[model samples]
Target: MARQIFHRSTSTFPADKVYAVMVDPDQLQARLDELGGPGAALLVYAADDGGVRYRLRHGIDPSRLPPMLQNLAPTELRIERTEALRPVGPGRYAGTVGVEIVGTPASITGTLRLTDTAEGSEFVIDGTVTVKVPLIGGKMEGILVEHVQDLLASETAFTQEWLARTYT
Candidate 1:
């Protein structure tokens, strides 16, 4: 079974500035260095008329995960997250993103939207964490939701700090 996760955050940076930070290679690499655990690196990046796409790789200790996840990835887990965002308007973009954990039955699929707001940019992520291992899939989903929620909170703080330093 798949469990749903919804996230929303407001960034003090304007839409264009926030979008630029999201697509900027250096910013993302730095972001991973700080948040993506040990040896996290940007694996891919691209830009086109439509928008931007990037992938990041990192190592996760399976022992730190929930019992079900640890069972699925007994050893260290390699995480690959890919995201693609395309411009929807002057200050809005819609995209699909996914996280792939090698050697595991769990993956997260979702949609992301970034829109301009009076104060700054509104970021929304609506998704589901799907675990294919029967009898424990729902449990895994619950754990994943908590993990993702924490990650998002950390990311928002990082973005705000980075934006202030780089843009302001």
Candidate 2:
């Protein structure tokens, strides 16, 4: 079975500005430097009238993994992540995100929605964490969900700070 993951965060910056920063390679690299575990890098970034798409690689320190998962995971979990965003309407955007744990049977797929709010923009993520393991797949999925939640919170905070510093 797959585990569900959901997260929502609001930004004081407008949706357009938030989307602009998210799609910028330099801004994304800065975010990785701050929150991405180790050897994290932006592997691909492209933007056009169609929308924006980027790929990133992130490394997860083995020490951070739960004891039960440490045995099943590599010394460092390498994750390849891809995100794409397209305009849904004026001041609104919709996106899709996918993540794969290299050399592991774990993956995550999600949808993102950015809608304009009076205060700024509301970002929402709806996703599932799937692990194709035997007896421990559920446990692993739970762990991953927790970690992803934490990571999303951190990224939101970072983006907010960046917007305040850069735009304010």
- Cα TM-score per model: 0.95, 0.96
Q: List the residue pairs that clash in candidate 2.
A: none
Per-model root-mean-square deviation over C-alphas: 1.2, 1.0
Over 4 Å off, model 2: none
lDDT of 1: 0.87
| Cα lDDT, model 1, residue 87 | 89
Candidate 2, residues 1-168, lDDT tens digits: the string is 999999999988889999888787888999899888788999998899989999999998888888877776658888999999999898899999999988889999999999899998999999999999998899999999998999999998888888888898
Best by TM-score: 2
Maximum-lDDT candidate: 2
lDDT of 2 at 160: 84
Taken over the whole model, the C-alpha lDDT of each candidate is 0.87, 0.91
- Provide the lowest-lDDT 10-residue window in model 2: 68-77
